[model samples]
Target: MDLLTPDLGLFIWNLLAFLILFFILKKTAWKPILKSLNEREKGISDSLATAEKVKAEMAQLKSENEALLAKAREERAALLKEARDTKDKIINEAKDQAKLEAGKIITDARAAIEQQKMAAITEVKNQVGNLVIEVSEKILRRELSNKSEQEKYIKDLANEVKLN
Candidate 1:
């Protein structure tokens, strides 16, 4: 049992050695080690703060981008609507022009038909007049071939003229 326990002399020697070592380490290494640990902790804190700031900026940028995208969509929709309206207006204008053209064509056709009808009637009247003149000339020539018939025809013309 005595061999298993520590001796007083040995304990005193160990205590002195421990105190000397503690003083030496405190003077040489403790300050620098503590300062380095503190600096490391400060760096970590600053990095975390920077990360938080960056996250906030990213969120703000994302929101702004979304707003711009929405604006773009609205503008695109407006442009499309304007294009459709313009197309409709152009189509309606073309329809109106076509209708006008059709009306003019119909009017022209009617005028041509009227002129053709007048021309046909004039041609028929001229033919009838010519036929009447030819028949009168033939009858006159046949009657004037004899002197007695000519004398009789002249006396008949004189009496008819005096009566009129």
Candidate 2:
């Protein structure tokens, strides 16, 4: 029972001592502690804001880079298409040139063959005519060995001509 109950005088003394100590601490430590807490909070808020800004800038840079990459791809595709077109044009031109050259070669070969054929035909005809003349001369020399015989054959040829 005595431990559970406090004396009036002791309660008054304890209250007085607590109030004095509270006032002393308030005057010495409260303002500095509050100011430090406030500064720390402000610094944290500023850092968070800066981080958010940097994140936004990174996102912007990423979008810009994507756009640039897309543009470069388009340019590359266009260049490839142009190169293909040029290559096709070159190939077609080469084919056309080759065709023309082949045609010209064929024409030249045909002309040369025709000229050779004509020359061979003329040479064969000349050779055949010369052979015929030589045969006729040998036959005439054998048959008309005597002048009297030749004169007799001439008279008979003239008589046949007169009958025709």
lDDT digits (tens) for residues 1-164 of candidate 2: 98999999999999999999989989998899999999999999999999999999999999999999999999999999999999999999999999999999999999999999999999988876776676556557667678998777666554543211
lDDT of each residue in 30-106, candidate 1, tens digit only: 99999999999999999999999999999999999999999999999999999999999999999999999999999
lDDT of each: 0.88, 0.87
Clashes of each: 0, 0
Judged by whole-model lDDT over C-alpha atoms, candidate 2 comes out at: 0.87
Please give the RMSD to the true structure for each candidate, in Å. 8.8, 8.4
Angstrom error at residue 29, model 1: 1.9
